[model samples]
Target: MVLPAPRYRKPANDLRPALPPAQRSGYTSALASPGPFTEMEKLLAVTAIGPDRAGLVRDLSEVVTRSGCSIHESRMMALGSEFAMLMLVGGNWHAIGKLRERAAELQEATGLTITLRDASARPKVDAVPYLVDVVTLDHEGIVLGLSEFFASRGLEIAEMSTRRYNAPHTGAIMFSVQMTVNVPASVHMASLREEFFAYCDAENLDAVLEPAQR
Candidate 1:
């Protein structure tokens, strides 16, 4: 049986400090600057979520640069109809109000739901045990198929990676995913293996699940 993602999440107890009011102007100025963020610099976290489509990244990049911010750490995921981006940007403008206005403008232009907030709002995620790796050729229904597999078995994915393969001859697209999952003591490892392989066979994708040696 297949199920939707279980809303699996990290513990909420972990906390991060809020961005200081004094850092706003400096952030704005740095974004206006024409360079990458230095070690000593700070960044504003900008997020955008909506239907996945063309030019989402390009449009956001242009809007952010125009507002004087430089993207540093970026994480993006496209799940069917939804697309999400988390960008750590370094700049001198810290006025969230201005950032909010700019995000509104981008939304008007792209029909995207955009948000600008201090990254500190999200809680920190502590390290955990158990990792899952899955490698496969690129195709539709990949993420959802595997996500369902994890959820059905009560596993939570902490992080995952997927990309297209660039082999000169084969030129096959691939997805390499590494995730951390919670294992209940009662679950049988062999049964989980059977389930994983069964799904992989049906989907015509190569997948492997094992205890992380590290």
Candidate 2:
């Protein structure tokens, strides 16, 4: 799949909704073909959520390692009191079932909801022509708030990275976020910018939206 560059940053609309095991669609690695494999190899998308606290990070890393999975990429964040994790894991295609089962176990132990999906079959990414940067203080309702704002305006957040900023002793909770979004041709950039600023102003958050340089 062709991933949209940073210019088109939109939330994946095609992402399958999370469902319970009995209702799940079953284990199928979108990353693998039917061809007989001499070696097992598949890509899996794993998601986890939990209350923000120490050692949660270590527990997650250990889970992936113990499952015989190799981490390809990871993006995570602490949304207010809750922590979210997204990981791209590579392992034998035949082991997908075991991985899923283990993932469920991990979720149970961590007391965090988790899900697994075939990253290869992920929703098609849309390409746009802009970059979005958001900086705000860490607080409850930030992720949902931002997602709602973008959704209301018909924007897609393609890729986002956020982290807390602080000095060693001080330990501040300020956050800086950068996202790429897909901008439709029909959208008015100027008006969107105005509305975005107004929205940020209301929330006391700092934002910058601009056209991406090719």
Count backbone clashes in candidate 1: 16
| Top of the candidates by lDDT | 2
**How do the residues 11-115 of candidate 1 rate in per-residue lDDT, one tens digit apiece?**
123111122354222222211123444445555777888898888988888877777766765777787789998777666546344556788988998788776
> What range of 10 consecutive residues in model 1 has the weakest lDDT sum?
8-17
lDDT for 116 (candidate 1): 68
lDDT of 2 by residue, 89-110 (tens): 7777656667787778878877
Model 2 stretches with alpha carbons more than 4 Å out: 1-41, 121-129, 134-155, 160-178, 184-207, 211-214
TM-score against native, each model: 0.42, 0.49
lDDT of 2 at 94: 54
